[model samples]
Target: MYHESVMLNECLDGLNIRPDGVYVDVTFGGGGHSKAILARLGEKGKLLAFDQDPDAQQNAKLIDDKRFTFIEANFRYIKKYLRLYGIKQVDGILADFGISSHQIDEPTRGFSTRFDGDLDMRMNQKAEVSAFTVINKYPEDQLHKIFGMYGEIKNAKTLASAICSARMNAPIQTTGELKTILEKYAPKFKEFRYFAQVFQAIRIEVNQELEVIQEFLEQTPELLRDTESRLCIMTFHSLEDRLVKNYIKTGNFYGEPQKDIVYGTITKPLDAVSRKPIEASQEELARNNRSRSAKLRIATLSE
Candidate 1:
């Protein structure tokens, strides 16, 4: 398993799985959560999972359970893929959205700041827009936007300018080369954080994570069964968590949900089961460092 499914027990709690209820693990990275779901299910219970990464496909092969079905595709097409198996609705859906540990540890895929690998941070190896493309080919303004919006970097313009100037001389092909160019802009006291934020911006741009996540969340209303159904999402970043929090509270991804002034109500298909997100317990954090930033939010279909 490349990534330890963060907050396992908590995710299962949010799932509220029934012995025979149908479930979907949208981000079945290591199959930790999927395996757990299966453990709680009856023989008849089914688990349908999706992960586009070839590495994840290899891990999926280790599972011998007939109740599990792995879809070798991105979860953005959740509803479309589920329909292929004659599944219209499921009792629950779980999404653990972020890069896996193996992707970072492998060094070749270039997801970790600690690695000197090539600038290839595509979650799906087949994806065209890699870190190289984002850094070397993207317009200065677009780079600035990605850095600012995705990375939340305060000096986004300066970072973008640095990349543009560096790339003009020669294309930045590797994570090390990109880091060297932006090293001057990195904060002296907090170099690691600066580089992390910068890398995060490029990776997000390369993968179109936020947009894809929004699309995935947008489809949950249709995939989930009414009232009894649950949608559990675990986000590792603020941009993702904010969108999930807002979407569950409001049908739209915008600021505030539209309201019926006369009735004083906002009728959304989903409602937040808990007002705040669930964080990993101290025990889980000690066991796995990756669970530190995980925030699990659960919602259920409304009446």
Candidate 2:
């Protein structure tokens, strides 16, 4: 199985679907959420889905609906691609971000820390950057920043120095090789957690994920038509979730909402529907282990 989408029912509910409206699934990983969205859409309704992974395209073939159009592209260009198809605005947009289960399960993709594979964690196969390049090629300072900022690893400095010192002998080309070099540093109790964070840091840098997310969020306000139009984003980590939360609340990626000088009122483009992110239900939590980290935040375009 590629992955079961987290909070499937809640995502559909938050969309505030209009049977005939236009919708876009920015992260059409396994097509689980896209199929659900298409079910609610009328014959006249259109659902444009985006996935940069070539593997996802095979999954897209399962849906033969004329209402569905699969775009083999990164969602950072959501507005550009939709415009080519004459979609200046959509009624709703749904994004389920983070690596899919298929990518993690397939050791060849190098996403999982469980099974050793090549040091490659690219979501897009064609992308030039890979985990191998980052580990062996990047300087200690850059690696330190990536681990600290992206992975939120507490001992990022030591980890970065370890990788650099080990790589002086030869390249760390595989997961097993890298893990072996860092063995001494891995905590006795939280070894898996440490490796996962290290791997996540490399993966994010390879994909430029946070930057793409920022670009994607910036486009959402202009993509939706009006107040009734909604944006549903499912984030798997705190960094991405924090960015989404801040953008929704402040209309910018940083700090509080900009204020109007005369009235001292904040100017924002979207009003968050739920003050807190929606978490998975007990039933969902029991089924998918991934939902524990999943956070669904929804907001609507303001008038």
Candidate 3:
């Protein structure tokens, strides 16, 4: 399915785009945001788009403009890859952390709980790990940690045990098989939500989602070319949003509040663009259920 970008207008406005500026769209799935950025660029402006999934590169529109370049690589290596293009810094960067509709709607790619397909949720198909390895090969204790930390499942221990037990009989290879195993443990009232949580946890572990975010956040300041350079990120879950928000406010994840630090004590490289996260409007939410969980956080590089 064609992937429609979330928070399109809000993100573009957040970037405060300039026609002559260079920008990066880190998650270029379906070219949704990348296309929008191109429309706003002048003949002299440039846009670099990155998507690791090679199939996604096929979606690149036939724009003959020399201003646009598509990079086939995961965004975690964004800094290194950009440097290869002689781009040491950028004017603005936009990242939509939500899984693209292209990945979810394609049952064969297998990102959705609704789809009865192979449990392969790697954002970068080139990645070595897949849901199969995470579920079948990962130690029970590690699985438990992923469920508890990433899924935040209340019955993490039991669920992890259940998965381990089932895999002993046979490998949990597909979404359908995994769902059957999880269904036996899901509470009656919260069955569906619990399954989603458990599956999401597995996906996160398989993809190393949290670690990627940490690396991406740490690399943000180095990418901004000017003092006013912007970082606009759209996150779907509270965990991801928390990382973005905290990173923008404080360069470090866990430390005493920086607001109390004396002058010259330490300088934060980013300045908050909004006091609070921005959410989809009522109209946008009604049209797209995916927009409901979306939260946009913006920050500008400090001088």
- Give all candidates' CA lDDT scores: 0.89, 0.91, 0.86
Off by over 4 Å in 3: 258-266
Candidate 3 global lDDT: 0.86
Candidate 1 lDDT over residue span 51-133, tens digit each: 98888898899999999999999899999999999999999999998688888898899888998999999888998889988
- After superposition, which runs of candidate 1 have C-alpha atoms over 4 Å from their true positions? 261-264
Error of 1 at 267 (Å): 1.5
Better of 1 and 2 by TM-score: 2
In model 3, where is the ten-residue run with the lowest total lDDT? 255-264
TM-score of 1: 0.97
Between prediction 2 and prediction 3, the one with superior lDDT is 2
lDDT of 3 by residue, 1-303 (tens): 487788899999998898999999988888888889999989889999988876677887555568999988878898999999998989999999898876877888778888899978888787889998999998989998999999999989998899899999989889999999888888898888987798789888888888888898899898998777899999999778888888888776763356544664555778788889999999999888899999999998876
lDDT of 2 at 119: 92
Q: Arrange candidates by TM-score, descending.
A: 2, 1, 3
lDDT of 2 by residue, 63-141 (tens): 9999999999999999899999999999999998867888999999999888999999888898888999999999999
Best by TM-score: 2
The per-residue C-alpha lDDT of model 3 at residue 266 equals 54
- How close is every model to the real structure, measured as TM-score? 0.97, 0.98, 0.95
